[model samples]
Target: MNGPGKIYNTINKCRICGADSIVDLINYGEQPLANSLKKHRDDVEQKIPLTLSFCKQSNHVQLKETVNKELLFSDYIWVTGTAASTKRFAKEFAQRVIQITNLQSHELVIEVASNDGTFLVPFKELGFSNVLGVDPAENLKTAALQNGIETITAFWNKNVSEEIIKKRGRAKVVMARNVLPHVSQIFDVVEGIRCALQDDGVAIIEFHNAGTILNELHYDSVYHEHLYYFSINSICYLFEKYSLYPFHADPSPISGGGYVLYLSATRKNKSKSLLQFMEQEESNKVNSHESWNRFAERCVEHKRLSREIIDKYYGRRVIGFGASARSSTYLNYCEFNSGNIEAVIDNNPMKQGQFTPGSSIPIISMEGGLRRKPDIIFILAWNFRHEIINLCRSKGYRGDFIVSFPFEPKVIQS
Candidate 1:
């Protein structure tokens, strides 16, 4: 049960531009919460209508339905410290931010939705101890506090920003990583950012690029928590509404490929790279409704082909790899249960005894999963395909592998 009562709501108007009409790109049907894993296989899961949409007026993509924010994030299991890729990126990101902004050690820095303070530790490592982490998850806040990072257990809103400004003063550096899309109250959060940031301060916002999601066919990323899939134009519109101007943009390794945008209150000179990137978006027609319709067509085709490939190896001993949130979306979308996949291997110990939502596939430890010695290793965490493949090889599991992304979905042999 999703709490005691109703937990779903439908949004008719565009959250960004207040448009009355929007285009429905893809209907995923009823889907479970991507991160909500069940303790037992028989445990019932809540399913909600999952539909992706496009706002022609704002050129932004968002979900038609929204799950309650408290239910989705109050007590969370996903942590940034679980992945090596994220850890390495945190270090690199800190270095880049410091170099670009010349951030001083005395200046206050805050990170929104700072899971386990993975990104904040790097700033401290560079002699910047005046860092704060704000998040809604109690477990994650506790974890970040244990790491000696100051964290506030609260959702980021205009009120919270005003409180922070009153207590800690306005921040010189504010970083929001992968949190903008999850926010249903987009305007409230943007206003909070504006209130919390100094006029000259730089706010770093990193999000999954909508153009990449369309062109790459990363449909598995469409989950309830992610309310919006922002294109560069859409993000610019959102920020510019609050008098924030993006001056620079860079590529990020997160979610296959993402964008790290630097914004400030003052309209400084925009970087050449930022201009070129927006021009490329225009050239690619990334924000056009026709492109979205074509993407929907490709999604339908990818689903058919992927299911065909999965069925072809149905008779073999197939083991699933990486019980990630994205894996939940892919598995449930394909309707794969414990019958098709023996068990899912996850590095996170918290998920080891849990069953995946909707699909009911048991999650197990990496060692236990490898010991089964299956004929095929179906990698659901396709973004870390190379990393998972290397780890499996090092563990002496020489078996055939299957990857579901970059479309047409291929199988590689040992």
Candidate 2:
């Protein structure tokens, strides 16, 4: 949503740790919605101002604007259950929580920003008497409820947190996977968690690790919706400020090129293992301005290499597969307009009739690939490359698949 000379401003200091240290890492300029690729009868387009900024003081990467909450969450289209990897991850997470915490049947396990009950279903099946999912996306919450998962369709702020605490008491285990960075007010979210969590409660928050994002040159993950890219160094500082401490952490490959952190609230002192991990992260200089510059250079290199390959293969029609949010970063950063990618293909029917947010790439059904027969299919959602390749092959679409991320541009034949 552009206007006449509208300027997006952000604090010079880190939002999480309140440090004056700051750095400019990646700038994707103005981009459209990554997953909002639907076609309306009116044929009008909606665009949002997008940019990525890094906290030099704490190494937390985030967006520069405070987008409308409604625009960010109310009618979210992305469903967590759509991806097999996510479903499997959720199942594993639930099982581990049950084992580690020795959670009884009467105990509660609540998940914030739980989309479509993907992560809550397993916990419910395990006979947890109280399983609650708090999400701002009304549409997704409705879907979760319909799927037999009990959920509250509201934003997880201090007010909602107080209500939950008053009614159901504090939660034993609160899981917020891939949600923290989307929030603009970091303090508010943490405070909400503090208010609702039991004295011994553990709040595991998994987000795209800032260290891995910079190291792997995942500039595409930088979008307006994702306000922050967290690192252990930054997150620990925030935890200390809010009385929530980092007791344990296990890095996992969940997002495309990102890592997840598991945190909790307790009076117990920081474990030696946790201290060592923090030391290692500091020694590696994951939050330095120099490291951010290197990441920016890599972003530029990726754009150049990807554009050159696509231009060379201009004779063949290019189509994008996977309507993922990360795909927006890839398309916008690389400047893939209508001329480069003919359309996008997604397995989810909800996205089939929609167009991509910023790029305006018309989203088509998986069958569109077989019918249209594009010569080069770009796997924009590169994380699921293997599964996508198999899907395409099964659908009888034989073509070179292009993967753009973590590594350079390459075309694989299947």
Best TM-score goes to which candidate? Answer: 1
Residue 99 lDDT in model 1?
89
lDDT accuracy of residue 89 in candidate 1:
91
Q: Estimate each model's TM-score.
A: 0.97, 0.92
| Root-mean-square deviation (CA) per prediction | 1.7, 2.7
What would the per-residue lDDT of candidate 1 be over residues 211-233, giving only the tens digit for each residue? 88988989898999999998899
Candidate 1, residue 41: the lDDT equals: 92
